[model samples]
Target chain A: MITLNDLTQISETEWEIPQSFRSDMRGPVRIFATRELLDHVLTDKSLEQAVNATTLPGLVGAVTVMPDMHQGYGFPIGGVAATEFPQGVISPGAIGYDINCGVRLLGSQIDFETAKPHLDILATRLNQYCPSGVGKDGMVKVSIPELDQVLRDGTKWALKNGYATKADLARTEEGGAFKGADPRKVSERAKKRGKSQIGSLGAGNHFVEVDLVQDVFDEEAASIMGLKKGHLAVQIHTGSRGLGHQVCTDYVREFQSAVRRYDIQLPDRELVCAPMDSPEGAAYLGAMRSAANFAFVNRQLLAHAARRAFEETFAGKTKNWHLHQVYDITHNMGKIEVHEIQGERIKVCVHRKGATRAFGPGAPGLPPEYQKIGQPVLVPGSMGTSSWVLVGTEDSMMRSFGSSCHGAGRMMSRSKAKKKFHGDMLRLELGDRGIHIRAGSMKGLAEEAPDAYKDVNAVVETVSQAGIARKVARLKPLAVIKG
Target chain B: MPFEEISHTADWSIRVWADDLRGLLAESAQGMWMLTGTEQAEGPRVSREISLEAYDAESLLVVFLEELLYLSEFEKIVFDGFSDLVIEGEKISGIMEGSALRSMEKEIKAVTFHNLAIHESERGLEVEIVFDV
Candidate 1:
C-alpha cells in the first residue's frame, strides 16, 4: 500500500520513491506519470513491486517505470531495471512469460480510400492466413531438427525458407535473430511446443490490425519509416507462444532452488533469479534467447501471411499491394548493453517487461536510413483506438536506459471487463464505428474491452513530456483480428 | 463449488478451499477448467495416470496443474476428476478421467507462483493462485 504521499515529486511528470522508503532496496524507484495517471497507479501494487525490484542484486541506478505501469505477477508491467553485467541477477519473471512478445509494423503505399471497399474481405483473408486463438497450430509445422534451425537462425531461417526478404530482416531488432541461442539448453517439452506453433498468435490480448496512418507529426522520421498519412499499414502483435511460456516456467521453477543455493533472498518467489555468471543463469539465458529467436521467426511468418492477404485483396486494384517492413520491436526482453551510469561506462543487462526499446538517433543497431531518425517504437492502442508511432530520444538513453512505454496498460480486471461488456455488443459497437472485427471467441473479446485499459493518448503524452520518446505518427484502426 | 474467481488487475486469480490437499488440488483444477470455458466432446470416457513429485506442496500443486495444462494443449485432453489419489511426502500419484476437449474459449498461459501459499484454516486448507493468461 504505497500511496501518493510516500513519493517525492521530481517534476511535473516525474516522481521518485527514495531508496530510504524500504530497508532492503538497493536503489531508488523513478516513475514517469502525470498526476492523473499516478492516481490510477496508486490503486494497485505496482509501486510496491517496483520497490521490490530495487532489491535485486547488482542493481544499477534507479528502477524506472513508465506511465503505463500496472500490477503484474512479479515485476510490475512497464518496469525497467538495469543490473551490473556479469555479476547481476536475471529474473525470468521480470522479462515475463511471453518471451519476446512484441509488435511488428508494416507500411504500404496503397491509399486507404482505394482499399476501403475490400476491408471486410481483407480481414477474412488475414484471419484465414494467420493462425490464431487458443490451442491452434500454426500454418507451418517443422521437425525437431528444423525447429532447432529456427531457434538458432530466427528470421534468417525465414529468409532461407522464402518467408522473409533481406530488407525485412534489416528493419527488425537485432536483425530478427539473437546470438548464443543453443537449442540443447532448451527442454524437450519446450522444443515440442515450439515445433507446431512456429507462427501463431495465441489468445489473450494478441491481435493483428489493419490501420490507417491518420496523422504524421515528424515528417522526416515518418518518411524514413515509409509511413504516410492516408495510407494503410498492418500491425502484428504476438510472441513465442508455448515455447516461451514453458521456457520461463522451467527456469522460474528451477531458479527457486538456485536462489536458495546462492544465498539470495527475495520478497517474492516469482522474482527468483541467479547470478548471470552462474551455471543456472547461463543456461536460462541460452534457453531464453532460443525462445526469443523462435518469436522473431514467428513474427516473420505472420508478416508473410499478412503480406499474402494484402496481395490477394489489393492486387490488380492497387499499383503497390506489397507491405514493406517498418520496424519490429520486442517489449519483454533482457538485453546486455553498455551504458553511461553516474559518469562511468558500465556494462549492464536491462530488463524491460512491458517497455519497448526506443534507441535514439546514432545508436549502433539502426538501419542506415534510420540513423538520423532513430528507432521506430510501435505502440498499438486498445481495440478501435488510435495507435502511435514514436521514436527514441537521446534523453531516453540518458534518463531511462533507452526504454519507453509499451501501450495503454490495463486499468481494469478482465473479469470486470467481461461483466460490464458483452462480446457481441462490443463487436457491434466497433462495427458501428467503422472498424471491422474478427475474433475467435466473443467472450474473449469482451475480456479485452477498450474501457478495460488506460487512455493511450495520455500514456503517450506522459512519456513525451518526460523526454524519453517523441511522436512520429498516429494510426487509426480500420479492421482488427483478435485471438 | 469450493472455488471462486477473484478480481486481479491483469490476469486471472482464483481462491480455493477444501478439506485437504488432494481436494484442494482437484478443486483448483476444476476452477481452472471453468475459467477457460473448456468443453468436452461426446465419446467414451477416457482415463490417464498422472504422477509427479516436487519439493513442497505448493510446488507439487503447480507441477500437477501444469501437467494438466500440457496434456490439454498437446494431447488435447481434459480431466474431469481424479481417483485412487495418493499424496505421500512430496509425491502425488493419481488417475485422471475425462474426455477429449471439444473446444476451449481462451488460453491460460501459465500458473504463476505470485504469493502462492496453501494456508491452514479452521475449515481445512485454503489457497489463492494467480495465473498468467
Candidate 2:
C-alpha cells in the first residue's frame, strides 16, 4: 500500500510519485488533487493502480491521475496514459468495458423559471421516452444486416433514417462516427447484443438529467456554445450497452494468450494487451472501433428520444422549444493523437478511462465556432449536486495529454451505500429541494445517493487550479431520471 | 457461507473460497447471483449442459461465470446449482439446473480478470473476483 508520505508535493494542487519509487516502472505518476482531496483517494487503491499503469510497455511521459481518481479493475478510473503508436500496446481494460461510454449535452432556450411549473411532467415524459433499467430492450431492434450498418456508419445511419440532424453530427465527437470500423471483426454474439440494445440506457449509475444553467463564468464562450444562464439543458449519460461489453470481453480473453506469444509480462491479467501492429492488436482495434461506432449511434438515438419528450412537454409553451447540440465527449476510449513528447512531435495512442478529452483552442478537427473557444468538457455530478461545463486549455496539452476529470468519483461501495441510505427517503428528500427524481428501482437509487461520491466542486477546482481545464458554466440539476 | 462481498470503491467484488475448483466455481456463481439480486422463479426446474476450457483455474472461473451471465441475459435463465461436475485439467463439464429469472436489481457489465488468482488457503481454494457494474 502507498501512503501520502510517498508522494512528492509539486504544488498546492499537484503531486508526483517519481519513477524511482518503483523498480519496474517506465514512467512516473503525476496526480492532480489538492491535499484535502488527496486524502479521499488515499483511502482507496487508486494510487497503487496508477503506479501499476506506469509499467505498461512503450509508455511515454507520465501516467496522469485526475482529482476524481478511484480504484477500478485494472487501470485506475480517472487515469490517462499514452503509448507510442503502432509500437506500444493497447489494453482493452484500459479503455473500459463500456467502450465509448460518454456524455451528451444539449442546450435549450427554455427558461427554467418559465418551465418550473411543468417540470414534473417533463420528468415523467423523459422516463417514458428514454427506455432505461436493467435488461431493457432498446426502442428500435434493427435486423442483423441493419445492425452491421450501424456498426459501419454510426450517426450516418441515424441521419439516413431521420433519427439525427446534420448540425447534431457536426457538434459530436469525430462527427459521431469513427473511421476504419469493420463489422466483420466483431463477434456474432456482440452483434446480437447490439441489435437489441442500440437505443437503451443500461442501469448502474447511468442517468438522463435535466439541469438549469445557474451560473455562467465565461460569457463569450457560453454564448458561442448556446448555453445561456437561467435556461434549461438536458444531459444524456450512457454508452454502447451490452454490445460494447461483449466486444471487450472477447478481446480481453483472447489477449491472455497474445501476451505470452509476444513475451509481454503484465502485473495483472486484466491489463493484457498486444502491440498495435500485431494481428491480435489489429483485430481488437477493428472490433473496438466498431463497438465505438455503435456507441455513437446509441447516443444519437437516445438524443432523438429526448427531443421527442422535450417537444411533447414544451413545444407550445416556448417560441423555440428545440434543443441544440452543444457537445458530445467520450470518457473511456483509445484515440491516436499527436502531441509534443520530450520536445518531439510524436503520434501516440492516448487511452483515457473515466477521463474526458479537453482539446485546447486552435487544436485541429475542432468545429469552426469552437476553434477559438476550445472543446467543451461535460462533467456531470451526482444527483443533488452541481455539474460543471469546462473548456480545454493549452496547458492541458502539455500537462495531462489534453484530458480532465470525468465526474465526482465514487467514495463509497454500493452495498454500503444501500445499507446507509434508504432509496425512497433519498428521492423524497431531493424532491423537497425542487429536484424531481424518477428511478426504476429504489434499491438501485440508493447505490447512487449524493453522499456516496466525493465533492465534484472540489474536483473541478483542482483541475482548474492545475491549469488542465477552465470553468465555463455551472449547472444545477432540477430533475434526475436514473435506471 | 463460503463467499462474502468485499469493499471496492468503484465496482462489485466478492471473495470466494471452497474445497476445490468445482466448489469454488459453484460458490462464486451463487455469490454473483446474490450480488445482482437475481432471484429464481418457482415455476419449473430445468437443466442445461455446461462445458468450457481455459488456460488456468482463474481464467476458467471467469469464463464459467461469463457463460452463466450470458445465459441470463439472452435466455432469461438463471442457474441454481451444478451437478455431474467434472474438472479435468483446464476443462470443466457439468449440468446446471435452475428456473427462469424472477427479478434482477443490478446490471453487472462483465466478469473481469483484474488481479485474479485462485490459490490455496486453510479450508482449500480461495480467489477474489471483480465485476464491472
Candidate 3:
C-alpha cells in the first residue's frame, strides 16, 4: 500500500513517487493535489495504480494524476499517460469501458429569473424527453445500417438527420466525429447493443443538470464561450452506453492473449495491452474510435432533446430560449498528438481516463472563436453543487500532457453513501434548497449524494494553482435529472 | 451464499469461495445478481444452454459472467441456476435457468480483471472480482 510518507513533495500542490520507489515502475508518478486532498487519495489504491501505470512500455515522462483521483479497476480515475504513437501500447482498460464518456455544455440566453417559474416543468420535460436509467432504450432507434453511419459520421449524422446544426458540430471535440472509425472492427454484439441506445443517459453517476451561471471568473473567456452571468445552461453527462462497454469488454478479453503473444508482463491482468502498430491494436483503435463517435452522436441527440425541453418551457414566454452549444469535451479517450518532451517534439497517444483535455490558446483543432481563450474544460460538480468552466493554459501543454481533472471525484463508496444517507430525505433536502430533482430511482440518487464526493471548488483550485487549467466561470445547479 | 460484497472506494467488488470451479462459477453469478439487486418476474422459468472459451479460468469466469450481464441488459433475462456444467481445457458449457427480469436496481458496466485470480484456499477455491459500474 502506498502512503504519504513514500512521496516526495515537489511543491505545495505537486508530489512525486520516484521510479526507484518500485522496481517494476518504468517512470515516476507525478501527482497534482493539495495536502488535504492527498490525504484523501492515500486512503485508496489510486497512487498504487498510478505507479502500476508506469510499467507500460514506451511511456513518455511521468504518469500524472489529478487531485480528484480515486481508485478504479485498472488505471485510477483522473489519470493521464502518453505512449509513443504507433509503437507504444494502447490498453483498453486505460481508455475505460465507457469510451468517450464526457460532458456537454449548452449556454442559453434566457436569464434564470425569467425561467424561474417554469424550472420544475423544465426539469420534468427534460426528464420526459431524455431517455435515462438502466436497461432503457434511447429516444432514437436506428437500423443496423444507420447505426454504422452513426459510428462513421457521429454528429454529422445528427446534422443529416436534423438532430444537430453546424454550430453544434463546430463546438464539439473532433467536430463530433473522429477520423479512422471502422465499423468492420466493431463486433456484431456491440453493434446490436448500440443500435437502440443512441440518445440515452445510462445509470451510475450520469445526469443532465440545469445550472445557472452564478459567477464569471474570466469575463473575456466567458463572453467568448457565450456564458453570461445569471443565465441558464445545460450539462449532459454520459458516454457510449452499452455499445462502448461491449467494445471495451471484447478488446480487453482479446488482449489477454495479445499480451502473451507480445511477451509483455504487467502487474495486473486488467492492464493488458497491445502495441499500437500491431493488428490487434489497430483493430481496437478503429473500434474504439467508432464507439467514441457513437458517444458524440449520443450527446448531440440528447442536446436536441434538451433544446426541445427548453423550448417547451420558455418558447412563447421568452424571446430567445435557444440553448447554443458552448462546448463538448470527452474525458475518457486516447488521442494521437504531438508534444514537446524534454525539448524533443514527439508524437504520442495520450490515454485519459477520467481526465479532460485542456488545450491551451493557439492550439490547433480548436474552433476559431475559442483559439484566443483556449479550449473549454467543463468540470461538473456533484448534484446540487457548483460546476466550473475552465480553460487550458500553455503550462498545461508543457507540464501535464494538456490534461486536467474531470470532476469532484468520489470520496465515498456507493454502498457507504447509501447507508449513510436516505434517498428520499436527500431529495427533500435538495428540494428545500430550491434545486428541483427528477430521478428514476431514489436508491440511485442516494448513491450519488453530494457529500459522497470531494469538493469541486477545491479540485478546481488545485488544477488552477498547478497551472494546468484556468478558471472561467462557476455554475450553480438549479435542477437535476439523474438516471 | 458463499459470496459477499466487499468495500471498494469506487465501483463494486465481491469475494467468493467454493469447493470446485463449477460451484465457484455458480456462486459468482449469484453474487453478481445480488449486487445488482435483480428481481425476477412471476412467470414461467426459462432455461438456456451456454458455452464459452477463454485463455484461462479467470478469463472463463469473466466471460461467463459477462454473458449473463449481456443477456440481462439486452434481452431482459436473468439466470440463477446452473446444471450439467462441464469445464474442459479452455472451455465451459452449462445450462442456465431463470425467469424474465422484472427490475434491476443497479447496472454493472463490465467485469474487470483487476487482480483477479482463482486459487486454492484452505476451504477450497477462492477469488475476488472487481466490477466497473
lDDT tens digits, residue span A1-483, model 3: 998889999999999999999898988999999999999999999999999999998899999999999999889999999999989999999999999999999999999889999999999999999999988899997999999999998899999999999999999999999999998999999999999788999888999999999999999999999999999999999999999999999999999999999999999999999999999999999999999999999999899999999998998999999999999999999999999999999999999999999999999999999999999999999998999999999999998999999999999998899899988999999999999999988999999999999999999999999999999999999999998
User: How are the candidates ranked when ordered by lDDT, highest leading?
Assistant: 3, 1, 2
Poorest stretch of ten by lDDT in candidate 2 chain A: A173-182
For model 3, the superposed segments whose C-alpha errors exceed 4 Å read none
Candidate 3 TM-score, true structure as reference:
0.99
The window of 10 residues in a row where model 1 chain B has the poorest summed lDDT is B80-89
The deviation in Å at residue A291 for candidate 1 is: 0.5
After superposition, candidate 1 runs with Cα above 4 Å error: none
Candidate with maximal lDDT? 3
Residues A377-431 of candidate 2: C-alpha lDDT, one tens digit per residue: 9999987899999999999999999999999999999989999999999999999
List each candidate's DockQ score: 0.87, 0.90, 0.89
In order, what fnat does every candidate score?
0.83, 0.86, 0.85
Candidate 1, residues A429-460: lDDT per residue as tens digits? 99999999999999999998889999999999
DockQ of 1: 0.87
Q: How many residue pairs clash in each candidate at the backbone level? A: 0, 0, 0
